[model samples]
Target: MADQAEKLRDMVDKKKKADKTHKVIAVTSGKGGVGKTNIVVNMAMLLSGIGKKVVVFDADLGLANVDILLGIKTKYSLIDVIKSGKKMSEIMIKVNDNLSIIPAGNGVEDIANINEPSFNKVKDELRSVVKDIDILLVDTGAGISRKVTFFLKSSEDIIVVATPEPTSIADAYAMIKIMFLNYKKENIKIFVNMAKNENEAVSVYENINKICKNFLKKEFKSAGFALYDKKLPLCVREQKAISEIAPDGKFSVSMKKMINNIFKENVKIYDNPVKRFFSSIFGG
Candidate 1:
């Protein structure tokens, strides 16, 4: 056990010395039940389809459902990586040719409310797993919790998912406000999900943008919208990404457009994925 831990530490140390660059994006929402995880899964699929090496880190912690949503059964999770000294590659479950998933473990409070030391330990274990990835999509839990913000702060960019509902809009604003105040994160991107139409989606984005500009004095980048489609629920029930299940569907098309817009702005790629992953987790 001690030898394995030492090897992991050494691997992290070596990664820290290397230069690797990759895009780190966090997909989060203001509140739960806004189809955030579904959006994340499909986004990964779309990004991977475009020939980008993508890895989805299920950072939803205790309420992890990425694996369930993707219909992939895993024998190990981040818990095993942290507690049992399991290598990250051992825990990562490949979803397809270019996409992989790192489950954060289910009902594990320790992984959710991880302390600095434990976080550092886990970071070491994750370094090698994240190396060489083109895009690291972190699927954070909804709301303004510490865990969510921590992941947001670590990312190169943040995509805030909001629906065309009063409560969701309000909560989304609250989340953006917290991030702006605490982390000085101003370049937040907005994706309006389940909109009735383009106008409804624009209205939703405008509503939040207006509030942030007026009160928080911040503006957000519009990442486009996903129309409310009946097929989405069926896709969820079948535990599959909409992009894979229905590539020509409206939801999949919107997701592809959103991904395109997200990368329109230039992103800074760090040299070392492992180092970048740890730095983001520990606020380094």
Candidate 2:
């Protein structure tokens, strides 16, 4: 463990001297069961299909489900990398030519309660994997735990997934409020999942946006809505992306638009937000 930690430190030191910029986007939710991971997976496929290099980090840690949804069997996870001195590249399971994923194995509580040194080690190991990547989408676990907030703080943009349910809306607002108070992050985006239609999706976004503006004094960009489709569950069962199962489906069309809006927006990508994120957490 000590030797691996020392190696990680050396790698991080070298990474700091290199020049690279990767957009770190965190896709999270206020509560579980909101289909956040599915969005992350499909969105990654869409981004990759558009010629962008994408790497997904399943930051949910113990409760990771990205690999399962992708139908890929990972031999090693982030936990293995931390405990067994495995390389990050060794654990990465390539989903396609443009996309790869870092699975977080189950029962790994250490990642959720990571300390400064542990966080640094993990970040260092990830530096090479993320170098020159176009986007690094972190599928953070739901809720406002210390682990969740830490990932959010480190990300350049956050996409909060929510449904049209009142409970989901309330929880989503709660998450936005906490993020504003804690990190003062303004580059937040909203993607309405499981909506019945465009109106339902817009209504969900408006409700949350109004609350954020009136109460929290913050706003969120609409990444668009994914209509509730019966085929989605079947696709999930098959461990295939919606685009792969039903490319002409409404969900696939919606996701394509979401990807379009994401790149169309003239947002600024900061330099090494991952390093800054760790520094903020560790008080370095």
Candidate 3:
């Protein structure tokens, strides 16, 4: 009986160690103005608030905004990592002891600045940084640029933030369809933003779900959604996180529960944020 007890203890220890594997969750949107960046920031804060180490990479490239939203000013961007041959770790700025951010570097001009070789270097470096962190949230640029699409396809959990507007839903569907046609990974988890309430959010999701099921024959696994709330805008205005500024806010509380739910299901939020770019782009 003593030997059996020791064996059980050993198994428990191993499981605990294995739980440290890091993940990179990319907050994506089909259209701009859907509050993807805010979602990314708040989620990162939630992870950090609970003692998880997180790295938020503002990969908006040319139009990066995570810095402005968080009121963080970075002296370097990913450009330095490729041009100067500096490690990704060197560019990451510690927002707090447990949270860090890699801002987009400037000075690299023109489309020629970002190429296949350069991007691979960036992705590899991102992989290295995320290796030591519990969660890495990437804030990608809006729209379907080759660069943006690459990161979206690379993410393990693609949290599509869409509003109830026709354009938002249409664009969301467009992005999802692209993923299906190109990457062939049909299961996408959506996070609807700015709905009137939970019922409205669910209604929006159901519409998307019905269309995918009937037409695309695809299944969308929902991560969850946030209702339209004044607190979100207020939080942004104050340069504070929703979870922090208004911890008891309706959207904030719902998001917290959603984060916990994602964890309990073993559904990682961080890993595979578009690890494969080329195949998802022109390959299909």
All candidates' lDDT scores? Answer: 0.83, 0.84, 0.77
lDDT by residue (tens digit), candidate 3, 57-139: 98888777777778787887777787888899988888788899888854445532488888888889988888767888888
Candidate closer to the true structure by TM-score (higher is better), 1 or 3: 3
Model 2, residue 134: distance off in Å is 0.5
lDDT of 2 by residue, 1-284 (tens): 99999999999988865534778999999978898888889889878877788999999978899999989987899887777888999999899999999998877766667676766677888778888788999999999888788789888899999999998999999998888887888888888999987888999999999999999776778977888989999999999998767765767767766876887732211125764476468642
lDDT of 1 by residue, 19-73 (tens): 3467788888987999888888988987887677889999898889999999888
Q: What range of 10 consecutive residues in model 3 has the weakest lDDT sum? A: 266-275
Clashing residue pair totals per candidate (backbone < 3 A): 6, 0, 17
Give the Cα RMSD of candidate 2. Answer: 12.6
The residue pairs in collision within model 2 are none
Instruction: List ranges where model 2 is wrong by over 4 Å.
Output: 1-20, 109-111, 265-284
Q: What is the lDDT of residue 39 in candidate 1?
A: 87
Clash number for candidate 3: 17
Count: clashes, candidate 2: 0
Superposition TM-score, candidate 1 onto the true structure: 0.83
